[model samples]
Target: MGPNVHIWRHSRCRGAGWALTSPRARSQAVPGTPRHPLVLTETAAVSLLNCLFLPRVAEAASLPSALPLSASWKELVAMWLPAGKASGRLMKNSSTSPLAEKQGQTSMEASSQSVQATSGYPSTSTSTSTECKPQVLPVIIPILLSILFVACLVLNSTSLWIFWFHIKRWNSSLILQFNLVLMDTLLIPIVPLMVTYFSLGNSWLFGQFLCQLKIFILSTHLYGSIYFLTLISIHRYLAVAHYSTRTLWKKKSFLKKLSLFVWFVLCIQGLPLFFVLKTSVLNGTVKCLSIHQSEFSSVYLYYSIFLVTISFLLPFGISLICYALLGAIIMKMSSTSLRGRVMKTKSLQLIMVSLAIFIICFVPLHVSRTVGVIVKYYNMSCKLLLQVEIAYYASWVFTLVNCCLNPLIYNFSSEKFNESFSKSLRKFRFFK
Candidate 1:
């Protein structure tokens, strides 16, 4: 006798999900939505109806054992109309009577409102999505992030100290490495807050401004580190394979200037995050910089794709090409001395480690995040979106590993710096 049943029985077309309304309800527009509603041919009404009403209908009346699960609309009427004369009359008049039409229209309006309230990429308000909760994030991501923070802080601080005070000679490669270290170190102060946030079940205690600042710093660190690693790869390639570029490689000023440019570009890229990265109080807890905290537009989706392409993909490709070429150049050399073999071994190690960072850290992070952005904008199913969210967070945790692994690059790429770092480590009683 409910209006919901009348709306579905009178609907002329089918739709995906539990759309208990006419086709007109599908055209309701939200952010990132097209002007026209996307039509889906799969019928969900029967299943939804059976799921919602069948058990009660069966329990109220003595149902036949031969009742088919895929009962037609008329069959459903026959099965349920016997339960009560009132419901039977209501069903009979639902199509032809004006009052029934009015009830169905009212039901359509209510269902449309519910759909619009729940669907879309998240907006400025808190999300009510219960299906998209990540099960492993609270346990896995916080532990990984904490371990990464400790390891990266110690390694990067030691590297920074060596580069600043112990190693007197600075070249293009050292300049690049030092800049990379600075990026990693800059991220150090932000990690504990993030760890605490994840540890406390994604609840952020910090205010909105710090939330935006945290996201900005994280973005800057990720892309800045990628840029410097690519630069290091190219510099090493030129230094080892092309003797003619040695003089250029010896000049540190060019790299310093380039580092400034990189930071400027990163700042430009991260500036927009402040507007979109907002904190929302959900279930009385503040959630910061969550994908669910803001609405996504078509423009934002395109920008995210562009960022993934340029910031992550482009640098990863360049690093791969440079390392491949370096590998080839190292292979062609016929040197048999210990020093030559040592350099060759180190070069190969650098290639593997750098490629590991790219593959493990950058690739999945960008791909999963970009896919998640697309899925969110298109308002995909909660299960698919949940999978993407899991992948994105896990890959993001892997990205922090790069900060710990990058110090290996300094040791591999430069002999003098490596010796200095070794001596510094040996001075510690722990290393001794």
Candidate 2:
């Protein structure tokens, strides 16, 4: 052969070998290649070029389909040329040089895969981390809450009976105690449902209406219990600080009206909960006490913060001031007789028990709930979310146990309440 013809034949053989060995070419290979090293016929070269260029032609055709017919052909040609050149160079080199073609295709595939993998992997990991599971409250919470439910039911029931029928005289203190008992009684029935909910891993079996009702009752009880306790402290203050003002609080009718007013206000305050509170599926598990999807979640959060502040913090502050003033008065009083000293001691015990109830039962709940509201509104990190969830539920158990503690408080602090309770028990032959 002449020099130019020999060079053309040599180039055609190299190009054919490269095309046959390429990744894309191997995938599209016909089954009739000879068992000799790095050789190709003209027919094989044309087939490989057609296979490689077909996909690029389809991609180029799709671009103009999306554009208007009057769109500039220059832009269309500009976009098509780069993709066409890239495929063309691959085909040309594979056809010309077999050894370089295999190495180049392998590197290209590896780099493309690495780029795709690097981009793809983090997205999956990020999604997994962001979907952190809701915190699971400790199993002991439901157990403890169940125990409190039973004890609260019995104690609050007895307290209600004694105040309603056993006690002969109903003073402002007894009236406030009766209201407190009534709140506890109303709240106790829902505790078993709550126990079941927590025991079943926060899955709410109860329907939506009951879920809303439970939330409303619990909220009402929370505020009512605190408000009444504060009222009792204020009553004690009035009795001690200005003994002459006894007749005003002494009237049963006035105390009854005040208690009624408190109930009215609490019910009004809690009406919003009916709209906000509902049962819904979260993370594929049914949950109760979650706010329904609304444009007003932020509105509800602010309202809740306000309600807690007014109903809890304000009363808490008032109770502290009243108790402090009462403590000052008791210190100044003359206690020459043993009976006077005993009465003074009992009064001090009452004050201490009230303070203990407020501090232990309500403070943690309010604090945790405040943190929860902030976390929910601001979309905090998963770690902060889990922490707030744990605190909120743990403190909630403490709050639920308050009813059981109140009866003990009454028995320990109030001489009249103890006598009435003992009489009622003896009448029932609970203790012979």
Candidate 3:
């Protein structure tokens, strides 16, 4: 081939003509044979450009059909050619060699990009993952949990030591409070694990079995504490309000049997957790008890409802009634004597603290969790579901406060335990 023919063939192959030519130059580059082949008429160039770009643009932008020749050519000029010296440089480069190949490579790259976009490959997956998985739990959640973990560890440990060592005599009230202490103690170790999970942004490093076990222990502590508090309130109410039942309330045997029954019931209630509580991985992070609201099952909804009613609602009612009656009875009791006034004050303290636990801790958790389940089960809007989920998790974090507060129940339940605690505290310089 001759020099002009070689240059023309090279420029055509590299798509350099699209950038270099202009409407005013149409007469110079006319359709002709290869011997004089520095020629592509406007119609031929338009058809060639459409063939090169239409499929890619259509797929990328979801266009219905090819744009008109004038519109497409104008857009193509706008895309590849810059103004002033840049256009001159592009023309010079096309007339030469290497830059034309670069232009062709850039076109190939753009086509590849459109193909990638059409196939849904790049930004879509990342955006979806970010939208689906929560960014970070509320800052206060881990903070409060860490505080509770420390408080629960200290208070429950002290209470456990006092009950086991300092208090020589064990009455039914002390026994019941000791069981509450046991529940708190059992739950204390789990709190730090929970804090770690939240601190790591809701990742559960523990395996599936441990996840189920963690939830199981939490559930057990929750309902177990509720039942124990209810039993304490009932026993106190019967002892104070109904004099004949004082003998029954004082008997450790009856309380032990009742405690055993509570444990059995709690065990039965926890069985479902082994099935429902699972460790799931979301966007490569392992999660436990962090199930998305939309993924909840109908069966889980029903189970949650049943669990809340029996474990929370019933005991809550019974405890409320018991405390109300006990309060009334204590109020009516003669406070003329120092002993009577002190006894009344202690009883009042127990009533207030237990009520605080029920209201501040249990009620919000049960209400939020139940509402979350219902909203999820019915396939509600994600907005409402997310609000409920936030409420539920917030309540869950606050409910752990009960472990730290149960020691107050122990303190207020019996005068002997209080005396023993004071003696133990006095032995240390902190209480001095």
- The models' CA-based lDDT, in order, is 0.75, 0.72, 0.73
| Model 3 spans > 4 angstroms off | 1-135, 244-246, 291-296, 430-432
Error of 3 at 104 (Å): 34
Q: What's the best-to-worst order under TM-score?
A: 2, 1, 3
Clashes of 2: 2
1-432: candidate 2 lDDT, tens digit per residue: 222223224555345446654555554444786443323333444443333333444454443213232334465456556756765665665555676656656654544444344334323334234454666788998988888887887888888877777778765677888788888988877988888988888888878899889989989999999988898888878876777765677677899999999999988988998777677778888778642233356877888789777888899999999999989888977799886687678779878889988999999988887777777677667688678787788888899778977887677546789998887778789655
On lDDT, the candidate that comes out on top is 1
Taking all chains together, each candidate's TM-score versus the true structure is 0.70, 0.70, 0.68
**What is the alpha-carbon lDDT for the whole of candidate 3?**
0.73
Model 3 lowest lDDT segment of ten? 1-10
Worst 10 residues of 2 by lDDT: 1-10
Query: Which pairs clash inside model 3?
Result: none
lDDT-best of 2 and 3: 3
Once fitted onto the true fold, the runs of candidate 2 whose alpha carbons sit more than 4 angstroms away are 1-129, 290-295, 412-414, 424-432
